[model samples]
Target: MPRRSLADLAPGDLVDDVFLVASKQSRADRQGNLYLTLDLRDPTGNISARVWNVTKSLADSFESGDFLKVRAKAQYAQGITQLVVSHLEAVDPARLGLDPAAFLPKAPVSIAVLTSQLRGFLKSLDDPHLKALCDAFLMDDAFLADFTAVPAGVREHHAYQGGLLEHVVAMMTLASTVGELYPEVNRDLLLVGCFLHDVGKVRELSHQRGFDYTDEGQLVGHLSLGVSMVEEKLPLVQRLLGEPFPPETLLRIKHMILSHHGTLEFGSPKLPMTPEAVALHHLDALDSKLHAALREIRDDPDTASRWTRYDPKRNRRLFKGSAPPAAGEGEEDLD
Candidate 1:
């Protein structure tokens, strides 16, 4: 049976359902029993799930990145939802009945459709240098396959199938409107930068079952890897197109990719130095944060007036709204 959400939970109910998600398992207490810190994400929203009651045998089998089916009771703590685990299983392929694909989060958009739109946007870029650079990178068969399917984030906005494409499209939308206000920011270059900025992420994430990082991804990270990919294409662009892209243009585009977060503390190695970089940085942040809010809104009303605890994604509480009474209808009249 499909698992019920924490919002749909009540005390003493037997939660026989399994929630497949990214997890971290660690040992604690006198007997070296274990506790689980889990990132519980469904299509609805993200929650922190806890699994307690572990002995050596149970602790030994529980590993991070492995799926676990938590049989637990729902409890609210400090305005957050938690599952008090009863029986936990390291989901064995032999008996697991739930649809695996349903568990992984996804953007509510079509990948094929969004990909075509993205390609159309790329085709429209007029700058020879920018268009050539975008073409060289985007035309790769393997990269396009991964890019269309990868998640933009592990959680947050666009953390589903076709998520990467949706995120890029959203960024392009934000960049388009913002680029108009700043006349100095080259329109085509800005658009190209916005689309290409996160291309490095195809290597950064391992999206097979759950979103995790490859060893290379953990060591090099996305921004550094992105710069390396662009440099790889630079040789090709120069060879075929001649004259090469001006060094300044390459530097500016790379800086936008490197510094789109606008600060060193935010994983950006440098600050946004140009007007285009500044616009790209905020537009990127804008789509991410805003989409997170939009997801929270969708999850809020699903259970109808019940509290959704607090969403860390939104940094506040979400609750279902009461339905308005119908015209000329009375609650007592129905009875």
Candidate 2:
């Protein structure tokens, strides 16, 4: 039988397909019967699934990043679409002629386009130190390869191959425009900061099997890792430029990386303080939040409803808005 995509599933439809197990958990209901909860995914998107009356051995048998052959029925509840799985078995994706990459999504824009845009932004830098720093990263072939391929996030905004490049390029575009409006804001600093803010994610995330945190990522986090990455490059920049990078400028760049999350509660150890730091924080937040919201609307399986499921993390349901009238149906004759 042919595969059915998670995005195309509707309530009451049967599902028979293979999916990458993004995550899996064993939990018990009030009566204490063990069940399995899974985050099943394909290239298009992911859906939550439940296997009731499961044994611990079965739940532990399949791990995240493994592919599963599932037989299930799609169901909708509380504004979310999920699968009520009847049967599931671990399978070798290779034997089934499935490449793991086929289950991962790619960025909407091509990597070539994104790489060009990033280079354009880096090339636009005027400050000698900033330009040198950006150049240091650009000249590193291995880093460039990962930076262009790693997802901006595991499952949040821009969660696909080449997503980091897309997010950085988009944020740089916003920073350039916003910098023009505020003359006091350091355009070079802000632009560079935007480019480097999430660079650590390239090391923090492993996209080989499925998106998951690396040991360094889980322990040290992207923010700290990002700071280290910059520090590692500073010496190379100095060697190339024949001088030590400015202390104040380095301080600010480090601040921007550490504080881009905006607040202590949000995992940023320090708050955004400098003008460029503040701008980078807000712009990063804006792009990431907007991307997530738009994706929620675009990928919500409950298409019959206008509102997406309540996102506990965001604390609100997105309003999908009324559909546009069909092409010629809404046209008024303008005399």
Candidate 3:
């Protein structure tokens, strides 16, 4: 039988398939009985699950990152679909004939297309120093592979395979279009800033089995890691140009990367201080928040209503009204 993705599941459906264990926890109920809470995932999405009357041995059998063959029934509660697991067992991938690709979500855009667009953006940069800096990353085969595969975030944003690349391309496209509106904004700097702002996510996230933070990612975060990556490549960039790369220009680029989060409270050590930095921050934010909102609407299960379930991340309910009629759909043209 074909595997059913999380999106395919509906209330009252029976489930018997393999899924990745995104998270697992043990908790006691009001009756002081132990139960297991889990987040079971497949490429399309995840569902919260509960295994009541759990045993210590059952809890010890699996972990947050394991793959399990689960027997469950889908149920709706509090406007969300959840799994009530009756049986589950950790399974070895090779033995189950499971393909790893099916378990992880992927970006809508193809990797080749995203990589080509990324290279195109790098080539568009006229500043020799900036071009060299970009080359230090884009030209490296291993780094490019990781950058292409890593997600922009664990869950809040573009949290899927090839998501980092997609996020960068979206930001770069936005930067290009908006930069023309404000001639005062340095286009090359802003474009490069958009590309590099999340480059460190390549290291910050682990995508082998599922998207999760690395030790370094948790300890230092991407902003500082990105700064260190840029600084580490400075000598090579200087050597490529065969001249002293201007310190002031490098500092400005670094500033954009460090401040693209837009505020100190949002994990940026410094707020956007330069025109290009400010533009990059807003462009980045626009792409991320819009993507999050669209994903929420698409994944929302409340099809009976025009409004999506309230999104805690966005702090608002989204309108899910049908698309308006196309230009000549129903009424005859009066003119």
Candidate 4:
């Protein structure tokens, strides 16, 4: 039987044996019915689903990332497609075979090329403290294995393979150009902040093709995990320098990492209190938002006519083509 994505399924349509993949889940509704939400993706795009409770506890039996063989009542309402779960089972290769690509998102370009650009940024830094920190990770076989090989965010721009390197390089380029405008923004510090802010992502995101969260990510979170990464690297560099890192310099660089997101509501513990901190926050936000706008524009230019909702982190809407003149006269009308 052909696989039916959540988007293709229509209201009240009976669905028979097929593989159902769960991408998200939610709390039970007021009617006491449970719901299983999923991202049903295909070669085209993804569609979301709302599955009502099942007899076998489909929500509990399978998981957010699990692939299940299921029977469903398909429907669509309010621009969303849904599967009312009738029967479901967790899939195993021995029991039910599936094409792995159906479940995971793919990258648009070669990750290796992006990774090389990240290495170039590290090679360019001149400050001793900033250089030490970046070099420690960029050069280490184990850390680079993790850093370049991971995704930058769980669900945002550059969220696929080699996304970490891609994000950092983009941020670095932005920081370099933006720093030029404000002489007060220390270029080296900003570069360091850009490179290390997401270093914890190496530990936070699973490098496997599916790109899931790691145990450390669930427990400590990337902000704290990044600080730990800095702490761990200090000793290695200190050993080579024949003395310890200067305390205030180390503290400031670390502070940039902790505060780069800009506010408590945004998961940053502290607001950016320094020029470097503020610059880093805006630059990071700028890179992600611009990348997202470009991605959305490339995906569908028609979206340009509509004012997209502002991205909370990046703070902007995306639009494409310029509007046509409203009920205008022909071209050569003089004032």
How accurate locally, in lDDT, is each candidate? 0.75, 0.91, 0.88, 0.71
TM-score of each: 0.81, 0.93, 0.92, 0.77
TM for candidate 2 is 0.93
What TM-score does structure 1 among the candidates reach? 0.81
Relative to the true structure, candidate 4 has a C-alpha RMSD (angstroms) of 5.6
* lDDT tens per residue, model 1, 105-177: 7767888888888888788887888888888877788888889888988766787778889989888877777
Off by over 4 Å in 2: 332-335
Better of 2 and 4 by lDDT: 2
> Cα miss at 329, model 4 (Å)?
23
Candidate 1 pairs with clashing backbones: 105-160, 106-160
Q: Kindly report which residue pairs in candidate 4 clash with one another.
A: 10-75, 11-75, 304-320
Q: All candidates: CA RMSD in angstroms?
A: 4.5, 2.0, 2.6, 5.6
On lDDT, the leading prediction is 2
lDDT for model 3 comes to 0.88
Candidates 2 and 4 compared by TM-score, better number: 2
Candidate 1 vs candidate 2: the TM-score winner is 2
Where does candidate 2 clash, by residue pair?
Answer: none
- Two-way lDDT contest, 1 vs 4, winner: 1
Q: Between candidates 1 and 3, which one is better according to TM-score?
A: 3
Cα misplacement distance, residue 331 of candidate 4 (Å): 17
